[model samples]
Target: MKLRRRLGIEWTGVALAASLIVCGLIYWNSLSGFDNLLYDRLSEYDRPEAPDDVLIVAIDEDSLATFGQWPWSRSRHAALLNQLADAEPKAIAFDILLSEPGDSEEDMAMANAAAQTDNLLFPLHFVFPGTNGAAFDIKEPIASLKQAAAAIGHVNLLFDRDGVVRRTSLCFKDTANGTSNDEIVWPHLMEQVYRQINGESSAIFRRLGDCQQPLLMPYANRGDFAQVSYAAVANGEIPRAFLKDKTILVGATAQGLGDQHPVPLGDGGTMAGVEIMANLLNDITADRFVMPVSTTMQIALSLIPTWILLIGFWRWRPRTTIFVSVGLVIFILSASAILLSLQIWFAPGAALVGLALVYPVWGWRRLQATSDFMDGELKNYRTETPDIPVLQVPLGPVDLVTEQAEELAHAIKHVRDLRRFITDALTNLPDPMFITDLDGKVKFVNKLAQSGVEDGVQDLALDDMLERFVAPEGLEDVKDYLAIDQELREHDYVDFTSVKDEIFAMRRARILSDEGELRGHIHYLADITEVANAAQEREEVLQLLSHDMRSPQAAILALLDGQDATDENKRIESHARRTLALADNFVGLARIKSSEFSGEEILLSDLVIEANDSLWPLAKQRGIKSTVEDYTEGAFIIGEPSSLYRSFANLIDNAIKYSPDDSDIEIVLRSIDLDKQAFVSVTITDQGNGIAEDMLDQLFERFASNDDDSHGTVKGTGLGLNFVSAVMARHGGSIRAENVREGGARFTVLLPLAPEPEELV
Candidate 1:
């Protein structure tokens, strides 16, 4: 379908999606940078190394305090290695870079110990030129340590353009006398290490040339990882027995070691240098990596879902499509969150954004086109045109003159016939019709108007006619409307005074001559008596029914609760009373419909007092406190006395029924003046299970109740509040029900106070 023919909801969804896509594109680089930082940090903290079985023998603060700042004599390292060898660890790694020559004798001892153990792997470093025109080098102790360890590998770090460490280097380059160069990578480290440990090289690292580069690992905060103090390890506080058949990494964590790099790790600081190596080791061992889908694939995936949503919305109504689109968006977001939690990097913002933007625009254009087409078709029918062409006969000279005269006569007759037809149609219409000459003298009056006019006023001037029959206010409006028509050739329609209790609408349109001269005016009067009478009858019926039925129903309920009634009889009587109450509700609805109720000024405080007195017995029987607070004692409002009483009674009854046995139902009356109009407000708040947020909007609608299970249960007719709403509306007031933030539902009735005539003026 064309875009203009799509549903509004589809178009709206598309618009949202487009907006998101635009926003995402605008912030692409920033978002990508943030993602990279987040992943790098998470990976540094949570990457699985050699499992929990691995241990770190730290050279910590306590060790420094006991044995002085690190770079302890190689002989001390020899002793520590020897102690660990007894535990039979699977392998051992040196996170620290030992480069400078230590005591020759101690280095020899440590190297000898390493050779005998055959488990240690030493770290190598990659150096790069710095900004200050100087070369920085990472030195790993090679001379004395070369023959001791099974393998050595570089722990090179790579940072993004923004200087944020995101990727790690797994290889290093070595040149000898400008003659030969060798590249050593993670595969090389693993190959030598496995060969030495297992006594044979495994096929896993055999395809060195074809293997992918360093794996991408999930990142987390630095504190997310487990760390033990170097002091504990050096003092043998760590469970040495558990180190058996495990890998161990020994590294430095002192603050000034220059190993720290800015990463999205713990507390927005860089992860300790040792932690980065540990994570890389974990990535190598466990093979946990992210294989990012290509950019093209990402875009395609995003667009496909959006297109599907748009298609579905196009086939649905605007409102339904909107709901569905919203639901889809929510689902998409939720799914994205879940995927992220599971470490699956799917493009959420891109896909959902596209969907949101495209659908709405598509739907709106579609709906607009459809509406325009329909409107064009409707216009064709509203316009008037003759079905057939008129015939013209020609004649010569004298014959032509006579023929022309005869033709003119016929044309005049046709015009007269048309006028008579119009006049006759006007007379039969429900609206009163009148025609006047340019002098404002009455020329004709339709049947309805003639019947309504006084006996002597068969023909009269417009001004005299108005003065004799129209009210002064209505007369002034008519005169002004006529004056406007005279000056502008267009006049505003004015409402005429009600005739015989019927509302009348009047409008005067100018009748112009063919020469563009003002000829006369056509006055239209419509009798809206039926419409008014129907409204008034509805109100009266509602009031009468509410009043008549309540009396009997209340008496029956009182009899049911009387002391003379036995328990069984009371139960039976209660059921009967409830049935009677339903009937009373029906009657109230009828009275409300008939417009029988009228308003009067009554003190809000007095109304509350009377309501409390009447409902107190029932509330006490249920052991609920029915309290009333009248803060507007002198404040008066206009409403039918009986209608107001019944409305409050219904609210109190509802509160009593819903509230807990010992809970309190609070009733308050107060005066509020807004926009200089006084209103008396009655609030009935109940300590009941509050209405749900979703159901609150429909609370006051007729036959709408939260209680769905009405089988054999006391169910109200649902007309009590409906009647109350009707009564309030009649008195130019309103009632609203809402769930309180704290608890329970509160029903508020706001009634307008009858203003004095002078005040109205």
Candidate 2:
């Protein structure tokens, strides 16, 4: 589904880009304004060097001042041409048209002077909307001037749509379907001069397929061409040697004469008509005209980069695409400039338009697509998860992305609410708790957890936090337990007293992500101070009872033994022994339940021997033959000595009570392997009635006994087995009882072997 959505967005962008490229190619002329403007600006960097041979004889304000303007007589033009002809110039072109008859004497003088010159060219201009509805009416030099020594050519200028003269036609064909004599083709006046000088057409004219084809002319700098004042040349004030071997174009340059037109000089100024011809003649002579690219090439150049950027959108990020877009703009312009320097013109407007247009359009479309996808996903989430109601406001109408933004905002609000609820629950927890990351840096602490922390606890190291609150005596033990891998630690909780004398049971659990990856830990510090204090008081009371009550029981037994061997005395002695055993069991059970496990290295064989010896007197009275087989060969385990001694002693005493007279009670100690870890197992078996089948599951439970059908006169106190079970648990060990199949019940106890002192170090 995501793949399809992504493809859809890509296709939309491609289609938009293709449309822009097509429009650029189809309506290229409509967009040429920018290209022309750019061309005008770029042309300034490499303007053509004006040739020394082409010179303009300007009828400037000075000339008009001297020669008396306001339709200066034709005799003045005739005199100027005669002077130019005397200079031995290559050619002379008269820019002032003389189609209509002028004053008789001046006209005759101009005609006679033109007849004398060998290389004179006459101007022939056209007037639009001919009298007979022909395309245009040609105005030529008068009949006598035309029949003189040289050819006639048109002096019309070609302009672009924006009224700037940038191109010229070398020749114009007569296509009005007139008579053969009228169907003549005329070259530009500058072209005629070039032909007269070289005896051949200019290079641009020779290459034209048709006389009407326009040539893009590179202009010389304004006023750069050599010029002489008309009055100065006409009166021989300027030296003829300066005009020697030059093509002279004579025309008006004065502002009052109104002979100037706008050119692509980029200064928004005008050039005189004679100066325009001078530049054109220079372009023709040097063959330096700029040819525009073919239509197909222009379209290709414009579309290629636009499409490259369009494709780039799919691969690059928004930032990269933006840079690429700007780069494409620079590339297109640079290419245009380079080509222009090589005398080739390429229009960059359409290409630039495509690049500039497609970028933001595609960005908007992509953002809209992404917003839509997010909206759908968020809606799906709202439907699947438990509904969290949010108030809705009417927005009336909006864009899709804006609406999606609102939806996203609402979703974020709901998430914040849920987080706040969780935070409040944790803050109000009865017990203190803190959260830490995998690096053991505390990330969160509840109110209760902040009790002893002087400053903010966030991001504090776990060990540092523990050191701040945990009492000095238990800090090392807590740290050791926490240092062990959570999965490898045998115990679930560690007990520690805070600096404030409050006891706490700290349990750590993993905080996992939804995929069950461990992200951190949550340490819950349960306040067990009151429970611990009560347990301490109970143990003290039990200890006092054991010592105080055992003294009286022993005195009673001792008195009875000295006085008589009567039934009453024997019964009193039996009861007193049972009472003493009961008190010992109560005290041992209380101590095991309340106290923390602090172990030291002890030999398992020695403990077993000591337990057996402690109960030897009772076993001897019952005539039970107690035997110990030491197969373990001195295995050491870490355990509390007092608890372990009472546990083993109680096991042997139970065996003695259950066994018949003269039966053998065997205690075997052996080292064994359980789950790849070293352990010591103690098996005690008695030759007596086996345990009842119904009592096996609850054998280790408190107050559990098999005394319903007694095997001996002295019955068992149910708590003796319970206390032994508690002690075994504290030592990271286990005990189980089962029928031995031989006839009596067997008790197997397994305790993990402690590492050697050297190994621990």
Candidate 3:
């Protein structure tokens, strides 16, 4: 039955997945044209030019300063063009469209002189959406000049929906003559002249030109390219030799002319219309056209990536699928950028937009299906009944049978009420709860229990669920309770290991009927491993206190019994001090355990210094050498000053206590690197009888003794080490004990460094 349901889900997923794949393929087919259009637009926006041997004749602020206001007379433009002609460039194409004739006869003469150059190709303006919705029109005289110049093409620019000029006119319609002519666009007038000089036909326009091709001459948007001022050119300060054969563009470049267009290559501002035309001509002349991606290919590429993402998402968990989807999108965007850099156009915005829409829709559908399935299952459970009968009938007298029947009916109602109560109680419990029948099949599970089940495991059996989610020891205890067919209830906790390797404790109880019939087992898991360990620790400390207190008490008792020498009084006093120190450790432990320790902002360096000072006298008496290594110049920590001092003093005292007479003890206080999180570590290492490797593991454990032959032989209570550990823990720090390689015990206490209040602000 379960296999059939699973098969149904799989079939549904597969069928829907196939539909999405087919839809993606269809969408790809439809998107080709749009993507191609985008590519064409992007190509027009890209800055294309050969890296070297190209000089931009910029019309800059400097040129403006030299030439004064632009729209210089046509005679001056002719002179500038004539000067450039001396260089004998391969081609020269005019970026300026001479839509209007010059102002005077001398200007016309100069324009006619520039136009007479064989290499020059003038720009023609083919205006669209003409005035009063009239038909597109081209300047009549400008078209006539096409016959005189080398070549003439329309200069119509296009901007994106956002009003950014990213596309330039590559081809335009000549509606004036009712004929459509697709003409090649050039970067500048000089390029067209260079091409004509080299005897190259305009047919070479279809291919990208190499470095050896016609030079790209750039015109600064402010008309700065012209070397001599208009006055100088007219006055013959600019040599006629310079204008003899050059291609020159004569157009207005003054700011108020309203002839500027935005280009990404320019610094976030509009370039002069003439300069933009100049850039386009340079791009074409150099054969640096943006590589166009066909419409069909764009759609195909977009759809393929989308389908791959959907299929991967269908197979993986939600979190895993989300990560994979995000990563794939990033990869696609990065690839698009790389292609764009290489002059290959791709539709990044369209593709990303499509995926972004599809993924959320797909995920929502999946979640909806899962939710529907769960709702149906719950409905079925509510309407269904278990096979087990609530009660059995027995033979009896008539009156007794009648009364027994009423009693039985009442009992049935009572049992139903009890079951409802049990269900409600289980639902409200914070801990996870599960009940399995005598046959080891799951009878019911609470909400928390369902949550505990791993993702993707919908239906689970009792044994399998236990083995997978519950700890091994807990599972064994559960099985034992089921096998005995008896009620097993206990406050004892068993550690359950989760899939993440974290341990949790489960407290279990087996449910049974009043007649001693096995019904099912109920388990409540409480994650109290930390708390359990703390309780066990407290018990051990109490035992250690008893043993440590006995030694001092025995010495005092002996002194009272007159069993000492002439130094009895002094010996008794020393013993009393040792006892008082032991007692103090217990008091500190209790204070910390009860949350009574008052913490303050204290300098860790000062505490270390104080600890070293206190231990120096003891070290001298024991004939042990000691050194304090302070690396924390002024680092501070938030902790109880007395508690912290006592903790360090205890460690140092222990080092002095265990070290051989005249042995060296090193106490180092330094800050450890924790990836920008500062921590102060105080290390106390002693050349003493080092702890055994096995004993080191339990060194911080309360009442844990090192003596294998005799338990109480150690002079001090084990509570001292436990108390030290407690104090460190209270300060959000930790202590570890280890045996050094050179035969000594080392104890390192790590504390979090406190920041200054001013720094916090």
Candidate 4:
């Protein structure tokens, strides 16, 4: 069944089962005397009127008060019977047994009195059930009294577990010295009296059918039955009108006899055994009984409310269903009370109890189901992940289905909230992420994880930990697999190339449980393409700078070979300074666009002078004339001063190297206007074979030079101009390399003029 509807009937079934178990337990306990509560409750119903045909000549407390205690001679009981017979009663039934020839003459007197009175019935004391666990009657009536009676009937009363007399056996098995036929199947004293007076079989016993033959008996009234004192009857004080034609019972109602028992109709004190028999016989004769309602019928009636409750849960609100169930139970109970009032028996506690438990059991079941559903959803998202889990509780027991779903709902809500938080944290992360099982199978992959992977990639496999993708031929695996400086191999990480040549840093971590056992892997893949490229470019630039710096070292060695020691020493000093200047330039170029962005005003002439001073020794070694037309013009910009000096020095040194021996190299500074903004311009002209008209555009590019064909004597390192261009761009300036019409090359530098002192303010 779908959970929603299963929810309705599931708990209802639980209620029915639990209630049945409880009812059955109670029924068993009642068999052990607890059921007296139910029977005692039934006693609250109205009772039948006493059968006027039967009367008790009670041997009461008042009789005991008058007749001097109990155990009065059997001759005294015979006197009562004979006196009762004189009134022409239909039958005189004695509740007392004339057993054991006590005072033989007195016993003979009682027996002789019974023989003379034709309608007197003597008590046959049979064993089974009369006294608990005894097999046979202890003391039956003596031979004389037994022969004198019209019929011998067993007064074997049946008491319920609570010690209350609710019924009497219709027949008795007289396992004693009694004759066969009717004596062998001895009848109840009440039944014998009933047969003698009514002349018909009891209909109440027949009503039980084939059920376990326990008859339900009801009393006619509470307390005293129609009676006269036994002493009164025996002394002839009771009038004949009170006993005439009546079925008089001569039995002990005296307190000293201890023959009293709780009956269905008595108020509190025990009813005398004789009175109990009187009530039974009277009840039988009047055809009044409390027959047990058939189990089939009771079950059917119970289902009425059960179905109502189930239907309400299925179609209506739980509260309404619960109210209906309770109402139906009350109706059944009220109807049972009415039936019992009319002296009938009915019990529907099972159904009432079942419905009572339905609400909570159902609610608890739904709570568990909801928790399981939420857990399942969390483990693997059902329909796309929910923003907030909508977990709610079903109906409950006392809180009824609808009335008290709040508590369970809150419980589910709490768990769902936790699940949502975890899901959001894992799935919505900016970095591409994945979760894999212990077997190395991909269980989950976040959006970024999938998007960052190459087109053919879907999952990560354990076997490919060290070799995720094929390496290109001839690239050192050691350099590519491991970082440049590190020797340790990181097999749990992989760097794969995307179709767009993009690089992703895929790192995997082992997820472990609390006990430190490996659970799975949490892989995070991030796009590191730009970062990787920048690192490669920086490495290449450093290699180039290291190689080019050897040129100044070669020149310093060449100076030591000069003939004059002074000139050689002077040139060596200049070459050493030049080498230092070149090192500073490489450092400045590398540091230009870095985080240090402090700027200040520097004169244009100062930069030119510094560049010329550093390059003058090189010009002298090359037999070249290099001159700087220094101008004190405030030609500067708001930029790093060291980077600016490096840029100007690059242009001057290039001019000096490219010019032939004794060739003129002039450095001129001027001011220009573009877009109404003042800019400082420095021009360096080299008078040599520098007319490379086809390579002017590529001149400032890294590794581009006039020696493209390798035919020129000036071997350019090709990085200095690129460095110069980059440094100029960092200062918001421009560079130009052109063939001067006077048969040489001219390189121009243009920088924006720094604002005046007032403008700074």
Candidate 5:
């Protein structure tokens, strides 16, 4: 595939990958319905040997059948406890929260029986925090029953988002209103009962998310634990041998009387909440708790299906891609189920979603690429192949949905040639071209974008590619273009050197809709190394020839009579002198481009004086007075002495050349303060026609000038002010030219003040 098409595919693949990762992270927090279903299915395959330590004394329907009615009298519970106590059981835990007092005599009967063995445990229910009627009170067994109980722990269960009781809280807080009061914490019932049974204090707990700890309930199936009935115990109809040395959990399981929670193993079926706790306690006995797969690992593994399918679709045939994708998905599910059985869980559904989406998303991406390719093809063929052949899809059944697909296919066929042609064009192009969106993401690249990308590099930003290819000095302009920089956009064209020393002219234009809104930009890079090098060679030839001719021309000029020379002779001498000046300017250009100058602190006045002395003779011939203002001696700056003198001399020469004979030429030096920074300012103004409004902006650009023809100077070398600008840039100074109001052009130069040696010390 061509890179433009590849870019579309890459974008679609990345977007789909990002969405898959985000969803996997979300599932890690609160599992999706599909992920939850997978977990449920995996639970169905669990087959564990039954445990023997814990018993569930359920208040099932049979107990209700035998025990008269629901909410049996407290005396009846007392009778059950009394009978269980006689069996010398290790402990008895109540899942039901017996908060309010029953009949006095009945509560007394239950209390009296519970106080007998001191191995009784009951539940305490606290109001849910942030609820409308949130209560601060902790509901414990009635006073007499509380005294009889060995320990009381909260029976609050933590449910997941979909109302599945997946975890259990190790600790909870009592809140008066909707907020926690005093940050107090209370342990959960199972934990507290276990501590009491083992004679231990608090053990360390790790929380799952905010409050709950993951419950690795050793529960394999609903009937995994031994269950008896409340009525059987209450009536003493069961053998004590079955109950001896067992920890008993008591709660209602008769239809609506008990809390029924949907568990992973229950197959959409409900298990009694008390039986759930029984399994938890059984797991505690066996020291078996499930370890969840890490979220990072889950996220990474979730991308597997996308990677497999996307790579396969791009590299292989459709049938092979589907076969590989489907096979990988099956392998993932099977492995995940096995992991779940081993008490390690992974989200198989997340992988399934990623795999299932690759083909449709890839197809959609192809449709877009086809459309773009066709648009470009029409542009190329508007003068060559304007009449595009449109296929006429036959009118089939009157189903709009089916007809839409047929119409789409017919339309795509119309552009099928365009897609192939553009694909070939981009593939054959000698140079790499890239297109980017407003956000600087590369939307397209040619076949040669990165020929060596197979080894390592991928997902390179446009700037990164430029940095790799372009010279460091040119990288800034490349970045500015990438940023849609307004200043760079003002330039119609840019010429820069690549890191390989190749020359290229880059033309950037905004891609806009007919409505004149920005869509993005197209950057076309045209290599012009040979053309630019040939131009440079021509310039060097002119400079050398000019240098060679200047000596003979000067000899001829020097041989002229200064006082008795004819007007024609004077004019010839003048033209020859201009030629010599142009040659000298070329010499300066070659020198400046190749040399690096080091700076030392020097008085600006010295360079100024040297410049004035050098130009005084030229000024005298024109009868112009080159005046300097009286200034303090503190105008010190740091710069290369030669470059500084040359820069100032160029300014004075311009002033002398532009002004008429007998004109006053002036240079002023003073101190200025800005933003608490001290700077020395130099002002040079020529009493000539002030700078043109248009020329002021680009006055410092090489070969840029207001003078169209070479009028006074030799070919208007316009390299003068540009050299001055480069000098200032190197020295961390600034220069600006403005049209003076008094019929002259004013140039101001500012250099930051340097502290004296004494001050530095």
Candidate 6:
């Protein structure tokens, strides 16, 4: 929720900033004043060089003083044309309007002179919203003069909203008297003159889409064009050689003529109409018009810097954003100036406004969102863990954000205290304890664990940590035990001798997060040196009893066997063998108890047959034949080979011992399912006196044997059945003894079946 709010604020800022720029572009005319101001300033430095071949013949104050009043007659203009013709100027543009018919002789005289002049041009003018309902009216010189001139063109200037002449139209298009079906187009007066001199349309005029659009014109410095008095040129006071091959413009520059207009020269002044025309002609010949960017491009560019700062708000600090905002302003202006130099105008006002508007507004929104989020979180924190006392903030009138910050600091300090408490408790644990993360790198160690490791043990791999503490012989055992999945391991703890020869039982448990994510593991090592040593000593004593007692008993059986026909000798031999069997049973029990159970796959049918065959001699002596019944086709079980062999031998031998002479003993191997688990069962039944009802319960118990009432010859050792029971339990199996209804005792053992090799893999 908090993240959403912050993103919401950020996107809102983006929309607001983008909307401002787009709207500014949409209503650009109302916002173009500053753009024009900037253009005027930027363009001054990139003014074009004045055209050297073009000269202005100004009818200025000095020219008026010499030529009399402003309405100079056509006869006078005729003389001027005749004199310029004598000079053989390359092209002459008569900028002064001569639309109306004047005195016939005077006009005819001027027309005749213009007809003689080579490449002579006359001016045409337009009156917009013309007489009647026409869109515009075109004014041209009388027919005689127009027929005489090489070409006649319109003299029109394009004014911006500020009434400054910054642009020029290369041509004008209108329907005749706004009533004719066909449209007529008039080229600019300078364009006509340039065509006469160069024999082709100017590149600037050619690039226009419809010859009606106005293009931004770059100006040369004021008064940069060479000028001469019209009276001197007409009176032949100037050298004719100086005028040769020059394109000349003849117009009024006198202050009294009312031909002056405002222009963008970075000065609060106006330029003469003739000089403005000279600048326009220079631009066409040089092809130096400034092209404006399209509207789509304008809005796209305007949004760039604003979005840059808007996205930066998420990652940059307020101070850095402020500096970037200023940089964006400079960047916008610099871009405009650079584009201006390339003869392209990209006004920077809309972009500057976007950058300026978005910075502070976004700053406010971001701060507000953050403050609200923090306030909500702090309130919830205080409410949820009320027992954790929050420290009081500074006792003064403080802003909400500052107060929230103070509360957050207090909460952080309280968490740190709780962490310290947990650390202390773990440090003082009685047993060696350590923690490791998912990567098996140790992260924490109790004091007892640290004592066994070097300083700076944290962050060491679990294997490296074990190397420092565990004995070399026990390292692989511990590693293999740890490698098993914790939940699936057979035993919860494994014992290993440390480097100091102290036995420790290591146990591990998972560390889970509150969300039940498995974060790491905690290992505890409990010292069991004394317990392990006592068990070892017991096993050694059992080893002494088994070996030392069995040797003399076997010697007695060997001596008795040589004299076996006598009653006393047979009795001695029976006693000696019983003692040997007792010793073996006791030792086997001790070994199985002390050692770990390591198992291999053994075929149950084959092992049962082998056990029966080994006891066949005894069965033959008693005239008891044991028949093997194989119900199981072939079955295997995982168990210790020695123990399982001994266990099966004990059960079969007991069956043969109790059976009557020549009575058959049955050994059956079969597969059965107990509960839902698969197992192989071995049953040994003897044809003899059945177990007494009271002795059946204690048949497999240690020292609890059933007396052989039917045979009454030899007493059985009770240790065998107990040892068999122990081995069955170790192999995840069970043994049961019961009397069959018809006769003798029946012993049954069930062991879990081993999986196939493919299943194991």
**Candidate 2 local lDDT, 1-761, one digit each (tens):** 67357857666766576656656554648776677899999999999998787888898998878978568788877787777778898888888878988899998998899988899988999888778777888898888889984888999998898998998988888866558667668898888988999998987788867767776888988889998888788778888789898888888899988889999997899999989999988888899999888777877887888889877876898888888888888999999999999999988888877777777776667776677678777888678655444454445467777777877776677677767878888999999999999898999999999976668898999989998889999999899988888999989999999998999999999999855899999999999999999887886788687777889998998888777768888778878987887788887887667667889989988988999998888888878889888888889999999889888988898888788988899999999998899999999999888777777788878777646544842233488888888889889999998888779988999999989778896
lDDT of each: 0.65, 0.84, 0.61, 0.68, 0.72, 0.85
Question: How large is the C-alpha RMSD of every model relative to the true structure?
Answer: 35.6, 13.2, 30.7, 20.3, 18.0, 8.7
* Candidate 4, 1-761: lDDT as tens digits: 34455565565666567657545744553333433456666665556677676788887787887767577877777777777778899988888876767888888898888888988787877554445555654566788888888877778778776677886667755445466543355667777777777676577645644323556777666654677787777777878887888888888877678888877553666788888888778777776767656656666665666656655655767677667766887887787777777776666566565566665666577677655545544445433445555554454556333433454456457567867777677778877677778776777766665553455234566334223332343123423543332225436456666445667776666687845788877767677888889867886776666556756676766766654668768667656755655565565666665444677877778767887888787789878888878463656767776667777777787677667777888888888899999888888998866646656667667667544332243334366787889878877889887777777778888888899888886
Candidate order (TM-score): 6, 2, 4, 5, 3, 1
For residues 1-761, what per-residue lDDT tens digits would candidate 6 score against the true structure?
Answer: 66576768676856675667556664655568899899999888888999789899999999899978879899999999999999899999999999999999999999999999968999999988777887777789899999999999999778899899998888887655345587777888989988999999998777777677767888898999999999889778899999999999999898999999888897769999999999998988888889888777887888888889887876798899899999999999999999888888887888887877787776667677777777877777767754533344453566877877777787778667657767887999888899999999999999999994555788999999999889999999999999999989989999999999999999999999845899999999999998898888887789788778888998887776657478888777877877888888999998898789999989888888888899888888878899889898889899888889888898888877777898888888899997888899888888777776766667678998645453742233389989999999999999987778897778888999998788896
Candidate 3's clash total is 34
The whole-model C-alpha lDDT of candidate 3 against the native structure comes to 0.61
Q: Supply candidate 6's per-residue lDDT for 480.
A: 93
Q: After superposition, how far is residue 707 of candidate 5 from its true place, in Å?
A: 54
Instruction: Give the per-residue Cα lDDT of candidate 6 at 682.
Output: 89
Error of 3 at 642 (Å): 99
The residue pairs found clashing in candidate 4 are: 30-35, 127-136, 127-137, 359-396, 359-397, 360-396, 360-397, 395-401, 623-662
Q: Write one digit per residue (lDDT tens) for candidate 3, span 150-179.
A: 666555566554444555534443435453
lDDT of 2 at 602: 92
Backbone clash pairs in model 6 (N, Cα, C under 3 Å; residues 3+ apart or in different chains), count: 1
Which scores higher on lDDT, 2 or 6? Answer: 6
Supply candidate 2's per-residue lDDT for 730. 88
- The deviation in Å at residue 678 for candidate 4 is 75
Full-model lDDT, candidate 2: 0.84
Candidates sorted on lDDT, descending: 6, 2, 5, 4, 1, 3
What are the per-residue Cα lDDT tens digits for candidate 1 across 516-617? 788888888777667767767866765665666667766767766656757887767766666665666677666666555656677767876797788788
- What's the residue-level lDDT of 135 in candidate 5? 50
Tens digits of per-residue lDDT for model 5 on 1-761?
Answer: 35465665666666666566547555666446777666766666664555686888999988888877778888888888889999988888988778987789998998999998678898888764435554545777788888888988887776666777665666675443235445556767777767777886333343235335555454657787788888777777889988998888898787777588877665567778887787666555555556567667877777766776665665788788767877987898888888877777787666676666666776666656655555554445434543544444575785644555555555567568667766667656787566667776667666665554454223456677677668999988766655566544656667789877988887776778755788876667778899998878866776666567677778877877465768888778777876766566556656666556678898898788788899898889879898877474657887888777878888888777777678887899988888998888989987876666767778888878544432232222277888788888777889988877777777898887777678774
